[model samples]
Target: DLSKNNKQMDKIQKSLEAFLENKRKEFPRFFFLSNDELLQILAAAQDIRKVEKHCSKIFCNIMKLKLGEDSNSNQIYAIISAEGESVAYQPPVKARSEEKIEATLTEIEQKMVETIAKKLSKFYSEYDFTNIDKSSWVFNDIGQVVSAFSQIIWTELC
Candidate 1:
């Protein structure tokens, strides 16, 4: 029974790790938040009295920043409050013209792509790509590098 229990524990641990790895892949910016920060966010999320939809939206937006997603004031507030900061809530401004918003998004996207390319080029130089395979560690590292480069660009753009 003890051996069976140990095997079950190992399976559970492996599954948890795999889930975390998938999350990291999907949102590379997640690594930017320290464990403490994550815990704070989780705690704040639980305390949120808003409706489930709104609460999930807020959490999603905060986490989406890791994926280079743009955030509005509300999302910013959610993030701030999650950190246990006492900040006043100020509503977001009126929406800008669609054309202007589109133009700005296009510019940001272009900049992000260029930045990623440059970073990837530098990263490639440091690796022996000839031996690269899907299972290689370098392949995984490239994904992380791209995510980090994107986060940098997004933060700078914001």
Candidate 2:
């Protein structure tokens, strides 16, 4: 019975790690946030009054989010002070423009992959990077990129 409970605990720990990994992969910027900061953002995502509370956590100096209400739809609008950028609640009845072209996560990830590929290319001339999966962890953060190069360089010298 003790062994069974230990196995279950191990399984639960693995599941939680996998969940955190998926979340991290979805937003690499979360890498900069501490466990508490990331968890708080995930938990308080639905609140805006908390906006004023979280300003100092994410921004510099005394910048604040000025909250206003639209009289027509009674929707809330938040203008970021100093920067002047804003976020507003868009009504579902409104039509959105479909013509905007944006680079995909994969495309951006591919660019990141190319950076490390260039480094490895010097030694492994035949290693083709044409089809590297964007999901590769090479460029998720600066530490990962530096660690990758360090491992390769140290191995070569040894």
Q: lDDT per prediction?
A: 0.40, 0.44
Clashes of each: 0, 0
Candidate 2 residue runs with Cα over 4 Å from true position: 51-63, 69-158
Error in Å for residue 143 of model 2: 30
lDDT of 1 at 91: 31
lDDT of 2 by residue, 1-158 (tens): 99999999999988877766666677664454566665665565444344235444443322444444442231233324353433222221121122111112122234435544664454345333444443453444234334665575556557
Per-residue CA lDDT of candidate 1, range 1-158, in tens? 99999999999978866755564454444354544443343344322222112322323222221111343321222122233332211331222333332232233334444544665677656655445343544334435454664464456457
Q: What is the C-alpha local distance difference test score of candidate 1? A: 0.40
How big is the positional error of residue 72 in model 2, measured in Å on the Cα after superposition?
Answer: 16
| TM-scores of all candidate predictions against the true structure | 0.29, 0.36
